[model samples]
Target chain A: MSAKPIPGTPVFTGAYAMRGYALNKMCYSLNAAANRAAFLADEDGYCAQYGLTPPQRAAIAARNVAQLIEAGGNVYYLAKFAGIFGLNVQDLGAQQTGVSVDEFKAKLKAHAIHNDAVKAGRLANV
Target chain B: MSNIIGSVATSHIPAIGNAIHKGLQKDEYWQPFFDGFPPARAWLHAAKPDVAVVVYNDHGLNFFLDKMPTFAVGAAPVYTSEDEGWGIPTVPPVRGAPELSWAIIEQAVADEFDVTTCQEMLVDHACTVPLQLMWPEGWEGIRIVPIAINTVQHPLPSAKRCLAFGQSIGRAIRAFAQTLNVVVISTGGLSHQLEGERAGFLNPEFDDLCLNALINKPELLTRYSAHEIVELAGSQGAEILNWIVGRGILGGAAREVVRNYHIPISNTAAALQVLEPA
Candidate 1:
């Protein structure tokens, strides 16, 4: 089956996998507390050790989700990068949506309330 | 011969594990979610399946992005949960049913599904969280066969493929000669995306639609492409593909004994349902 691309979304395929191999490996290393601490102590040296490309290193330094995705960093592993900075998944989401963290959180709160109301038959679909 | 006595479909959110670890079960934020699990606990006690075929995805634990397997089955003698960045509380090592795991692997290969067989694999929260929630006493006596799917990176197995894989698992378990009562536990997703600009997106409508279809018309879920799942449920919402595997094990029909859905569980909606063979 021919792949149908989602508009405005970077789908992580084998091609992306190949492209982000080094970048992802670095992110995967964050699974260990020691590795996370090491990366935090020396981000550039760690990125250099992973052999990340200039673009990938730049994206990592910038904490740009779009750039990371474009550079082949899967969000699951990118989460480790976000965690290193004490950022949660929602923070990454906020970055991706170009919204402030508080705004993104408010949006999440609103969505949950709307969903609860929908479940209770108090509101129509949102 | 062994038979699938029951099936469970639930979200394996890591925060759920954290909640249990921190004794937040009675906390106002988690009381309702915790309340929903008693029926599951009751069902587990009543069913008392000898083995649990847990279907979950590895969250950068056992397999990294370097060698992501589309489908991998654990054939080890014991499965342990390792440190996943954050230091999670220690849980007892889960006993593995190698005999059953190998049987499924053999059948899956013969059935043309190239499954990666793992003799040693460390499980992550995706596998452990559900086990903690469903079998809080620890999986000491009951054995488990862990089936890991690729939901982390894209090009994930389609919902149709996951169902087919589950069907293959059903056949393998049924074909085994041992008189074992088995439960198929499919963990992950009911709609909350965890990545991209779409993170924190929760679609209770889509979650309900998926749950209703799972009970009445499971095949309806197959029509949704992974992208469509992300569109409706958010990017991480694609984890619902794991639940499709459980539905596949139940074949076309099963009795839904308990169902619970909640939103905003750390940027994801959570759903849990217990199904018994009809």
Candidate 2:
């Protein structure tokens, strides 16, 4: 599904598609130690087999499955959990969320020109 | 049926405070965003939860890539905000319930939930920072038990599994046999576009619906698969595990106190909610 927008915000066009609430809930009870271990061992593979993308897969591979399942419940938790495993979730996105750090600084530099009067001895804290 | 005293749903969108502090929220373009939270704060003040079990996703602050605990519980007495790169100014450390946390941990383990126990932690902005804003400092003698999730990573638990964990937590909390009033707090979102070219995006309509499902009808959300939430909320949205924790622990039905949402706070849309036993 395409992403929706807030009343005034424009639709953003980019490679990364807008997200939707489209997950299937899984039963999380473990009947045996073997089952738990198997789930842990194949957690990454399970997500991959089920169609989790690469960045998502990387996030799941990084954490202790037992702790993650208990604390975080799904993909959102896994994505954050991936951070613990050292995968940069932000960088995983193909689209850019905002201006780069350098870009931000350059914008500030350009904006600085508009307020030159305040920069002089005219404004106290400028 | 166990008495679910209260529950809360909050957004741990790390950038909210940053936007507020920088006067970005006050900017004309951002004014609508700041306006969304006043009602949220008012609602929380009325609910007045005694102790809160906050479930949220950590941003690689406490646990690292070397060894990450999928579901780690905080049994510490005090949880201080950590210096995650650009650190915040000095804020008093939040208090925690080591006893209750340990009790829940022990019970969850016995109940067959393998829970990780954390002693010392630098509670990142994703958790403690947001709590500071939503709930009052001294009211109802707030004590916390931090539970961190691995949401940003893949191979994470599915949505159904998360709701199941929340159910288990509800059972565990019910068996506590303590007289203290407990509130389950879940932090994270509906559909927020964080990161990438789609940053600064917000869907007020989706946010409203998510709050509705969480408060009056969580079952509505069950239809959504884990992948669906990620696609809608953002990849980082895996942090919504906190919501599942609330669903599990709160049990039965709830009275939602707050549902405030806003967007364009440093490339992330943010929302906050509070729930009470119906």
Candidate 3:
């Protein structure tokens, strides 16, 4: 059942959950508008309130999905944190890949051609 | 006696909720994906089901990492939607069927499934979006019993495990004393990742294989472990586990009524498939 890991795809494992619990809790709290506003009003205080680790705090400060992930933040939760600044999944993807928002979107849109191939039954079997 | 009429599976991407809210179904970017629902909708109209058993994952809305349940069932009289901190439009509260929920929970527990039962549950886009798409006028038309799977955490239930769980749920539904016609609806995945450098990743071939195997040879998919599925299908793409469970619930012979696949729906290979038992 073991398989080589996919590069750049960090599966949110137990270790990550254990490490990112605080960071994720903070992000999960943003589901409430009040919590989101509270975090916005005092970013540093919010992190402290959640007891974010130094690395987790740095990742949040960096606004880097990769770093946040490395610090144990799952994207589902991290997405709430991203929402604070109007960053969607594309923006997060672009940030993680070091590409512009347009470029990231283009990357996703380009899959349409591949989908057409599959629809046409021209795609090779897996 | 209660019976499963069929199963409908689709990608429950958050953007879809926004699109439906903004009346963007005809927008060029969304048309193709939105168009795929008509056939499935038509079939649903013809085969009216009284209740929907929705299988989906909670994206940090109902459960947090601290008390993450591998399998959870909604036992509330009603379920509400949350914005999930992203300002996505929330749908009206969907009615929940506690009797069916308790039946499935009792059966699952008796069968050693160890599923968590929630008296008060908040469903996320995964559960809400599909219901909205299926019943555009309103979700109030159908009562729902949501089965939330743990797809966010790494130690997710194996594909085989989800299949078995679905089968257990099917038995519970069929054995219910009430004469309820239920439809099993599941949301998530064809193949698109939204994490790390592989964000927006799509695998058309793998997606095609999954779509085909889901109908003909679902067991072929159980060979891939959860980690392996993440490697091949992307972290979020593993949401196909929901599909696997739906297919298992269908259990015996079934035919694919309709299927729609489109790429790049908010970082997902959006797919809609309807299957009816033979």
TM-score of structure candidate 3: 0.97
Would candidate 2 be rated incorrect, acceptable, medium or high by CAPRI criteria? incorrect
lDDT of 3 by residue, A46-72 (tens): 899999999999999989889999999
Model 1 stretches with alpha carbons more than 4 Å out: A1-8, A113-126, B86-90
- The true-versus-predicted C-alpha distance at residue A47 of model 3, in Å, is 1.2
Cα lDDT tens digits for candidate 3, B1-278: 79889999999999999999899999999999999898999999788889999999999888988898999999999999877998798889999999999999999999999999999999999999998899998866789999999988878999999999999999999999899899999899978888887788888888888877777678888999999888878899999999999888888888888878898888899988888987
In candidate 1 chain A, where is summed lDDT lowest over 10 consecutive residues? A117-126
Could you tell me which 10 consecutive residues in candidate 1 chain B have the lowest summed lDDT?
B192-201
Q: Write model 1 residue lDDT over A11-118, tens digit each, in one string.
A: 677788999999989988887889998888998898899999999999988889889988988887887777777777777778888889888877877756545543
Name the top lDDT candidate.
Answer: 3
- lDDT per model vs. reference: 0.82, 0.55, 0.89
lDDT of 1 by residue, B24-99 (tens): 9999878867788998889888887899999989988899976879999999999998876645555779999999
Relative to the true structure, candidate 3 has a C-alpha RMSD (angstroms) of: 1.5
Chain B TM-score by candidate, in order shown: 0.97, 0.84, 0.98
Chain B fold agreement for model 1, TM-score: 0.97
In model 1, state the lDDT of residue B6: 84
Model 3 residue A4 distance off true place after TM-score fit, in angstroms: 3.2
